[model samples]
Target chain A: MKRSDYQTEYKTDLPVMVTPLPKTGGSFRFTLKPWHGFVILMACLVSSGIAYAVTDKENASIFEVLVRWMPLLLKGFIFNLVISTCAMAIGTAVGAALGLGQISLHGWVRKASWLITQFFRNSPWLVLLFFAMFLLPFEITIGGLTIPLPDWVKAIIGLSLPVMANVSEIVRGAVLSLPSGQWEAAESLAYTRRQTLWLVILPQCVKRMLPPWMNLYAILTMATVLASIVGVSEVMTLTGQALSAEGGQTYWHRFTPLFYYCFSFTATRFHGGRYIWKRNILLSTKHCLRGP
Target chain B: MTTNEEMPMVSIKDVHKSFGDLEVLKGVSMDINRGEVICIIGPSGSGKSTLIRCINALNDIQQGSILVEGQEVNDPNLDKLELRKKVGMVFQQYNLFPHKTALENIMMAPIRVLKQDKKEVEETARALIKKVRLEGKEDNYPGELSGGQQQRVAIARSLAMKPDVILFDEVTAALDPETVNEVLLTIKELAEEGMTCILVTHEMAFAREVADHIYFTDRGVIVEHGPPTTFFDEAKDPRTKEFLSQIL
Candidate 1:
């Protein structure tokens, strides 16, 4: 059917344009997506406002504060990056396994996966981090060899537990969202259950899984700061120490709002944040491939 | 069970199927002979589609025997995947693997299930694509193709298995009025090539033209069946005549 036919059949007011939009004759089309320019304005104003508030006679310029402290705080960011990357890797692996288990034919396996996912998903992240930090044996005796568990390793494990649960939910939701026709088609073709899941179902689920998985990664990235509570010396921990070392309570007014402004902008711009709030990317792909 | 014509290609004897308490197929039985094109026609609630699905064991009968080439379908020892390889099916919604191109969809089962060489199967797939009149469109994904093109590709995908029989369940019902004839033509070509075929269809005219045997079903039973000329033109049963008149 032609594009126009769809509009008529559905009784829709929106015109369906098959070809590209008519190009603006102007040489430069300085177009910003809806709220993008506003966000950039906000970020600049909010950041400079915080910097200006912290300024004093001794620290005459806000530029001096930034110049002095930016490098030191950035060094701590490497640790944040490390913890998040490690946790995400672990979470994705465990989550995928749990997700597959949730759909398993065996009753016990499905139940066990459900129990595990629910346990971590319900618990607060701070409580899990505390459990990791305090409950786990700091040292292990393996054939008279002492293996000390670092605080950062425990933090990563704690962060991953929640991430794993969330990612598994994403995987399960993605798999379930696929139409029953996909399974029936593969089954009719003589593909075994395992073969159908691996070859047909999971491949289709990847499109569904990606945006949420990326979203989960962003959440997990921010959550890495929680590791500082247990003295992991990540970005948040170092930022605190660096601020206090530079000054006392006065530095809080400077760096805290700076942190908030930077984080808000990062959260808004990242894959998990605004895009998920708008059109769900994976579902839209599905709609594009399979017409309404 | 010798190489005699007495034995049916697929024999579904007194098969019964139900979804919970609602019995979909009650004592349904039919014998599909080799090189025959059977078209099953009925109203919406009839067991026509269910019966066709049972032939390929897509739905298991609650009670009865379904033997394909004299092999019991529900035999515990029988590998269902192996059985299905020989019984190709085309669905109403052309369920082409959307990720794969048309040629890839056709080549997948033979290469994966039959363990055929990629080069050899690609040659056959290309030929089938050409036969479906989808030449130069082999590289297009299902999403890129029109409904008729997708259905034709689905037919080619089934034929790539070189199955003993092919089942088409309302293959053209989901298609446009203009595109219906294109999908019907592909099926007509298959029937002309002497491929054993069974179709559940709403298109009475096409069934009348192409079907060697026509089964008129109502509720969950095949009430009357005969050659298309006898069934469509001179239906014996009152229900068959009623169905014919309504559809015609």
Candidate 2:
């Protein structure tokens, strides 16, 4: 039946309830569920057991070696998390400003902001990281007091450069996507440009920006491994250390670190996936409830 | 320069407007008195919507002057915020903020921009919602309301400013056929209460019923204008007659 026919037949004052139709198409698709992390962890454990069984009887068990190094590996992984969190925070704040600048009424401000965004976005992350590491001073003297710069801090600064550019593009896209009628309506209501943007425009942009912003965070988390190359001693670098310290050329030792990295990244991605899934459900239900 | 009470609410003098080389309004002039309801009817692209948009300086005119309550609309030094407060507008699309409820949409500008007392503004907003026949749906967002309901909320939002003149630019154009009458009736009631209103509409019957003066515009200029009784019955311009025959 037609939607209008349903409305006419009901003839009620209550808000109409619309149930969204399920999507069609039967191609095989793989989506990460909340329980996928546990499955991956089990696979890693079973493989390590098989490796331990095949190894020479004189050496320590693979599980024993993995357990011994677990705490140190987790410490490095936690540091990676800290860097990712701080970089995302700084990037989002600065990127939001740069994005707003792209839409500025002044031609110079818009052009300069666009240039900065493009410059950082197109540059390689590793090149930017190397630049931050080499170009910055090891320590600075201010009023006879010295403050030292850490390697992880430098890595964060490098990673956040591209994050800021992507976020700026996201913000500009979200703002421009709104109907121009919104501006006209707000202007007709006597709101200043700043008030209209902050009050009407940005509030709506937040919903559109959230999913992509979270996706960026996940990609940045995986990119945290890049910091290992710069001597930040994150998970990847520590895994290399743990492998050599074990003093063995066994297959289990070689295969163990890969699982550690995979498991940690998967765990983080699982959390992000759950959040985005819940948000999509909320948004779809909202769309269904909205009137035609 | 005359006193506000004696002067026309809005006065346009030989206004000419263009968009990149295409002239949309050519030498259009009219005076709208206090408490008068004027409707400008024309074919598409006749500049009827453009004319009302200019009254509040939403669009700049290349030449000529538009004065709202004796204040120059096109003056470079003129405060548009203050002018907009005096001359409110309702658009065809009813661009209500999706984030705000109907009541909040009405109360927002007064509280935020004018810095009014929230308690008093809330009372006035509630009354306006009732006036627009949206009492039970005050908390509903614009997305939850029908097109007509959203348009009524738009009118109430404009009225909340208490402007000297209100402009409606095809306010009912986007409404469903079943809901158009509700919006028209609300506008008609506002006209009956002697509010000064200028409208650009295709609703000839409603224009005849409510308007004190009717203007027929064609090709960027007013072809004919008079009271609805005579303008519709005795149109002198061939363009006006042909336009009326096609629509009516």
Worst 10-residue lDDT window for candidate 2 chain A reads A277-286
lDDT of 2 by residue, A1-292 (tens): 5655666666643564543234348856586774775676677677767766777557677777878888887888889888888999999999999999999999999999999999998998888888888998888789999988899989898889889999999999999999998999889889999999999899878777876887788788878888989999998888788767776434434444454456556655555434553332234445544645
Give me the displacement of residue B87 in model 2, in angstroms: 1.3
Q: For model 1, how many clashes?
A: 0
Residue B186 in model 2: lDDT = 94
DockQ scores of the candidates: 0.55, 0.62
Per-model TM-score versus the true fold: 0.87, 0.90
- Contacts from the true interface found in each model, as a fraction, amount to 0.61, 0.80
Q: Any runs in candidate 1 off by more than 4 Å, and if so which? A: A1-57, A141-147, A249-292, B1-5
Model 2 residue runs over 4 Å out of place are A1-31, A48-57, A143-145, A247-285, A288-292
TM-score of chain B of each: 0.97, 0.98
TM-score of 1: 0.87
Docking quality (DockQ) of candidate 1: 0.55
Calculate the i-RMS of every candidate, to one decimal place.
3.1, 2.9
lDDT of 1 by residue, A1-292 (tens): 5656656666675545343233557757664364764575566656765756766536546556656777867777777878888998998999999988999999999999999999999999999989888988888889989988899989988888998898889889988998888888888888889888887888778777876777777677778888988998877887788667766434434453444345544654564433442332244454554534
